[model samples]
Target: MALNDVEEAHVEDREGNRYFVYEHLAQGSPTVTNPTGKETYRHSLAATTVRPDRKGTPYLYTLNLSCRQDLWDDLQPLFKESIDSYRLVPTTSNYIAPDVRPWQFW
Candidate 1:
């Protein structure tokens, strides 16, 4: 699926790890209807990245938060906060994103 009207921004977690957040309007499958009988669109707020394994093959990772367009504006801030608060559990020792490569995984 193609993303429409995408907006991108950078956000940081409590521990100061930065992530790029992408917001867009995506066509919904099995479209939903509101109380008024009008079809509603889905809004996606997502953070994506590519991490490589020991062999160096990139793997995609994403955290997506979605809601109806009607609720997007009102809930955007809260969604952003929740996304920004994401903290990866330390692996072997401590959380680290030493090789933050620019990626577009939407």
Candidate 2:
């Protein structure tokens, strides 16, 4: 998908974990129409972070949210709250055994 009017920033959450955030606008297919008879468009927000797991393997974590462009102003605060609450829980199963191939495990 393509995004327009993109803005990006580096931010930290409440726990001081860093994240890269992107805010942009996305236009849906013109062939599809919403109930309002207008082409659909959305305000999209994405936040991503990379952190190591128990075995020191890094993984990318992302949070994405979208709302109708017209409702973005009203929903922005809620989206921020949700993103601020994001936390990574390190787990033992996050890594693969050195002797095993990824496909073999599945």
Candidate 3:
């Protein structure tokens, strides 16, 4: 792939652990009948060991991933349903509502 097509970045965590983020897509895009018919996004991130003698600090590891915005939106409902079916949220009989009108003065 050409250098201009990809985006490279790096970030450091609070603990001083640096992470390298590399993002790229397979290609510019596939031709579609309708210009706005499809939309997609892809990216990759990675962390790796840094050289001690290196001028700049380096991350210890790396990661990679790709995404298609339109495709993601279309599949989001199913994903949400799957999570909902998992019963991730607990049911409560007694509800403790937050104070909205005013706070209690001591």
Q: Tell me the tens digit of each residue's lDDT in model 1 across 1-106.
A: 4535575666544454445678778655555355442355688788865555555765556788998888898999998887776555434533233445445322
Which ranges of candidate 1 are over 4 A from the true structure?
A: 1-3, 9-18, 30-39, 93-106
Please give the ranking of all candidate structures by TM-score, highest first, separated by commas: 2, 1, 3
The TM-score measured for candidate 3 stands at 0.30
Q: lDDT (0-100) at residue 13 of candidate 3? A: 44
Candidate 2: tens digits of C-alpha lDDT, residues 1-106: 4545675666766465777777778775443347553467888787888876556776677888998888999999999888767775544655554344545532
Off by over 4 Å in 3: 1-4, 28-42, 45-60, 68-106
Q: Determine which window of 10 residues in candidate 1 has minimal summed lDDT.
A: 97-106
The TM-score of predicted model 2 comes to 0.64
In angstroms, give how far residue 76 of model 3 lies from its true place. Answer: 12
User: How accurate locally is residue 63 in candidate 2, as Cα lDDT from 0 to 100?
Assistant: 88
Q: Compute the lDDT for candidate 1.
A: 0.65
Worst 10 residues of 3 by lDDT: 82-91
